[model samples]
Target chain A: MTGWISEFMNHPATYLKIGWLQISVSNLLVILLMLATFALAVFLPFPKGHDDTQEPRT
Target chain B: MSEMWTAKLRTKWQKELPIEKLLPDDQPAYVASWIYVFGVLTLSALAMIIASGIVLAFEGPAWYHTSDAGKFTNSMHFWSVQLFFVFMVIHLWGKFWMAAWRGNRFRTWATGAVAFISSIATAFTGYLVQTNFDSQWISFEAKDGFNSMGVGAFFNVTNLGQMLLLHVAFLPLILGVLTVVHVLMVRKRGVVPPIDAEPALSNRGPQ
Candidate 1:
């Protein structure tokens, strides 16, 4: 029984294998993405952030 | 005095926490169309997702996969995710067309977009947690595509344990942290006003 438990815990990879569309969630990319986000926050400024003084466009 | 503590605790522990403890007075100064609802709605769904995710994580993967209560909770989490992404995408488009980046508020807009991207990644990791047929299929298919793209070696999509840890721990952690930062920034600066506000501010700041 213990052996079964060990195998199940260790060999979970044997059961689940995600394909390409799934890997689009690549963990590595997640890091690159985080960095890119920080970059955008600092640089390209897409979503207008908090600026209370600006009045609404007429 | 003793009664006050009990009442406070009860208020805090109720099934539905009074989430809107504070109200926003700083209006957008413009751009208050129906389209803006998508952004706030997405944030609401995100709140639901985080709450449901905590419940499922505490239950453990196998229980959620097999038990009746667990299954229901899992479904709730799953549906919440669907809701999050759907509203997020719509919110993104609405923000985009509004040209929300015009003023000093660009940072907020950019940060929001970044959070959206991170949220999508978090969702992808989430799908791998279920040890069901769908999870199995997604795993194998993802491995091939990712391997071809050259990221499979480092991140084996077929690894259920890894996926579980990532979905419940890593991705959620990042998302939570980012969310905190996003909220803080929004509170500090307030939402950007309408496009016309920009010119108005420019005309007044220096003169």
Candidate 2:
């Protein structure tokens, strides 16, 4: 049992647990993505008619 | 009771608002051109990507990379990601130039923009979960770049399990939800018109 733990730690793939669920560049990109998306959602207003209070001027 | 109040409020707004029920005569004769289709196409591609991704989830990584059915689906997912970005960028550019946000459509534009960014993240996470030699190599290389840039501390990129959760669980959900909301808002608001056009009914030119 002790040997297996050491062996896994030594392997490069151990960091990602790659054989099953692998992690790396793609995930980081996703993180960058989530941050960007979340930021945008918070800032941008919904389309005009979305606010019911506004009366059409024309 | 809240639903009733909400319905009553909506009915009040409908009666009071002087909103345009349909396109005015001043609006463009039609969507500007083929460029307009890029946004919809990108959306289609995103839908395919999610569908393919669900299958990959069911089959597991090894099955996806090794089995023929799995491999084809994986390739389709990969190609769809590339296609989505291509079309989405074009759509973004098209909207920017056309000034597609002139009228009530600002939220639609913003949502689409968010979806573009979110989809890219989803694609990035999917790439990380590929678990191949390329995936392995790219993770380490990408991390070094991030580390140098100061983003490495938050996300290691070298960890497969971490990447998988973010990719399959988090990124997709974010992108999918954002895209859906954007689409709904677009349907609700209708498209914005070309800049400088008069109302569609009164604004007449060459017919």
Tens-digit lDDT track for model 1 on A1-58? 2688786555434222466433333445544654454344334433555767576889
- lDDT per residue for candidate 2 within B1-207, as digits (tens), equals 356988889786565332442223332343444554666888898888889988988988788878889989999889888778866776676678767665566777788878778776667766777889878878877888879989777787888888899998888888888887876665555555455555562233212
Interface RMS for model 1: 9.5
- lDDT, candidate 2, equals 0.69
Would you list the C-alpha lDDT of every candidate in the order shown?
Answer: 0.67, 0.69
Model 1 ranges with Cα > 4 A deviation = A1-58, B1-23, B26-32, B196-198, B201-207
User: For each of the candidates, what fraction of the native contacts does it recover?
Assistant: 0.04, 0.00
Q: Which 10 consecutive residues of model 1 chain A have the lowest summed lDDT?
A: A37-46
Q: In each prediction, how many residue pairs overlap at the backbone (N, C-alpha, C within less than 3 A)?
A: 31, 14
Q: For candidate 1, what is the TM-score?
A: 0.63
Off by over 4 Å in 2: A1-58, B1-28, B196-207
> Which tens-of-lDDT digit does each residue in B51-141 have in candidate 1?
8888887878788878989988888888888767766766666566656655555666767877877787788778776777878888888
